[model samples]
Target: MTRLCFLKCLLDSHAPINLPHNVEILVGRSKITKIKDQSCSRQQLSLKANCDDCIVEVKQIGINPSGLDGFSLKQNCLYKVGHESRIEILLNNYIHLIEFQPPPDNFSPIKRNKRKIEDEEITVKKKKCNKTPDKDSVLSIKEAMEDVWESIDEGELYIYTSKGVKSSKKIAAFDMDGTLIKTKSGKVHPVDTNDWQLAFPVVPTKLKEQLENGYKVVILSNQAPIGKGRVRIEDFKKKIENLVAKINIPIQVYIATGKGFYRKPTPGMWQTLIEKKNDGLSVDMDSCFYCGDAAGRVANWAPGKKKDHSMADKLLAENLRLTFYTPEQFFLGHSIANVPMAKPEFIPTEVKTEPFNDNLISDDKEILVLVGYPGSGKSFLAKQIEKKSSYKYVTVCRDTLGSWQKCAAEATRLLQQGKSVIVDSTNPDIESRSRWTSLAKDMKVVCRCAKMATTKAHAQHNNKFRELMRINHLPVNDIVFNTYKNKYKEPTTNEGFKDVIEVKFNPSFDDEKSERLYKMYLLEK
Candidate 1:
């Protein structure tokens, strides 16, 4: 008989079965007796209840006439029996013996064991490697001397030889602000990640490795914000702490703030670090490395030019024999090729003489012509002259005119007033200067060129300083230095000028001398 039919009969007879317990009722000769073991029966009942709740209907149950053995049910029915005899009876009813498995074992212990092995291997490998010099292992001044080495154009090998003991250790220093953290677009909003953090993934990782290898990892940065009152000292400290944490390295950080000599491109910061390290201590300056992202900083301390050995790098390399590295070399892991070579420009020795022509200036009208290379103190000098002199200063550039006609009109008005007019413009070439000179002739004013002959080096230096102060992007490299040096046309005897006052800037005097020669020009009657 099917279990469903037997259940239906039991239900019709009004026989009550415990909902918590599975009832095994013997349905023979129209008598029903229920057997129950409360605990086990309850569990079995729960399982069967859950199975019944699933979306499946019991189809058929068939018994094998020849003795209850393995049998099969149609669908959705599960065989449940407490004894072997009952199981045999279920088999006789053609119920399938579906196998049930116990719950799976947790695999955490196996995974943990594998991880332990890997960790042990790593530790063992580290142990086999060379021991990092202890923090107390102060290098002798002589030993330090062995660390300085030179790089060749086509790559070179550095051999550190001291007392027949040779070991190579490379240290690389980095600048923080403009080189690493770009503050140009303004302060990194407290939320936005720094671009350097995004670009150099290997810096932090490699820094940690270098630290572990007993290499001195240091940062020599110049922060002028404290003096400018833009950022508080504590806030700057916190920002640096945050940067260090992200890098996961214990880097010795030195900040030159508040107009101290330690600012970058000045060698003060590097000097401070070296002096501090070398104070009455047997420390080798040779193996130490100094690096910065600023080209000016690198160029300032670079051997030659100032021929100044007062630079910390020079003291270390020449005196202590230490090597230096730039960020370009460190991050790239190779010497940089195609660095801008300082090609000696052809600076004219002779100044073009200005013509002594009556047309150069009109009666009782004075003309002040401002002339200089880009950022060569021209604007500042002009401003100073405007403040001191009674001359009315006029800037003639994109601000006043879209065309030359407008410029001429404004010049005409200033000239007609018989006022001492100053034109603040970059009259780099003779053509541009001639246009203004022609306007002066038409106005019948006395024309004089106040050349702001600041050297290319000085102009570039001022520009870099300004960018740092303003936290602005570095300006594009002006090819004017090369252009003017090579193809610049000087004002000569042919071009009319009442007087040419040469502004001598000593940093590079060749340009001044070249401009001064123009004063001797005399106009034809």
Candidate 2:
């Protein structure tokens, strides 16, 4: 028999049992008999037995079930029974009795410990599910850069770094056209001589601040009109000198016209100053800063119009300690009273390529091959094509390697996706171009090549500017230029290009060949 102990609470009414431990318990009704003493009638009755017997505990008693605490046993009340426990119930008038059984001696301890471990593991997993990356916390580039220059203030000690030297001095550089003066219908209106005299005083104030701060302010600009013979070099020089004298910013000025190294966005102008200082001059490039409105060439030509200095700015900030500030930001410290107000010219429209009205080319896939000598304006043209045409510009150097198998795999992927892709690379050899043509054929895609065949002299002249823009050395020797000139195979009718267009360097577009090239290459497919 199982040993058990039973306890009962006597009151005016019978009550159910409520036990703390999980035990198999049963309850029944019983009658309350009057005892000799009132205190004895209210006392709990207990029974003790051996191991085989069951035990029960009464919680409370009252006249109304709602008045009792534990013995109310309302709806939704739950009872749990432990292992090796049994319960019994007995019914009587206005009295309740309950019984519980004891567990057998052979219960397994190891299984109970394993069950506890499993329960703890489940609890830990539930906690981990609550932590994750918030959906709304992601940021875009423009918003992330909103407060980029908020900390900069006037009179702050600005340090400029160039060629590994750092200097704490204010170096002010100004862009001429829209910054210093306004140009109306191709004619530059002098600020002091014009009605906008008050607007021109900002230059003098900026210059005065620089002088007070012991700064070396300079003008590094590109005067392309001189190269085009629209403006004489002497006349341009006079205008610059007159403006500087009027502003009272006694500063050195470097202007690059036509094809020169010292130009903004290109480090040549800054590099030239640094070299001059190394020769015992007083100029300091380390304490110099470059401010410009446009990225590269001044003209709004197709290839020259795109911005190129974002990557260059990143490089300059890392290597030269030179900070590039936009005009919108530079005006934060200075007053806008002297700043020239000019609206940006909107001329060039996006090119559009129309598909054949009929189904001459039924396959939706197409391959666009961009061919040119290094710095022959290939990337710029490719970008224009990508923007204007329906061709997806795919970078082969970073995406696909020189290996034939890898190239084939990537081409197949693009073709399957139904995207017309433009491959921008130096495809100087027939074998390289042939691989792209073969991929197009295998994938049933239409293939075309837009060759940039600018003259070697033109490419070389542009190469100098490109080198300046890169502020680095040419990867190959002069042999690369010679090879590009001599070894270039003009795309012929047999070269597998469904359509082949050639581009040349022509600042003036009066020639029929130049006009045709522009229409064919720049217009669209």
Q: What are the TM-scores, per candidate, against the unseen true structure?
A: 0.35, 0.32
Candidate 1 residue-pair clash tally = 25
Best by TM-score: 1
Q: Judged by lDDT against the true structure, how good is candidate 1?
A: 0.40
Candidate 1 Cα outliers beyond 4 Å, as residue runs? 1-216, 219-363, 392-404, 471-487, 505-525
Please give the RMSD to the true structure for each candidate, in Å.
34.8, 34.6
Predicted candidate 2, C-alpha RMSD: 34.6
- For residues 1-525, write the lDDT of model 2, one tens digit per residue: 533433233222333244334353333233433323332223223222233423222222221121111112212223322332222121111332233334435544232210110010111111232323232111111111111110001101011111111122355666555455554343344322222222244667765676668765656555554433345444554565456557754555555552323333344445544543233344544666655444322333233343322222322222335665544346445343443333212111122233322221224458777677776666556555555544454434312254445656776776677667667666776777898888888777788877775655445544553332332323223567777667667776477878776654333234564333222211000
Instruction: Flag regions of model 2 displaced more than 4 Å.
Output: 1-170, 184-200, 277-287, 295-320, 334-525
* lDDT scores in order: 0.40, 0.42
lDDT of 1 by residue, 3-73 (tens): 22122111123352212123333221122323232211211211121122211112223221111122222
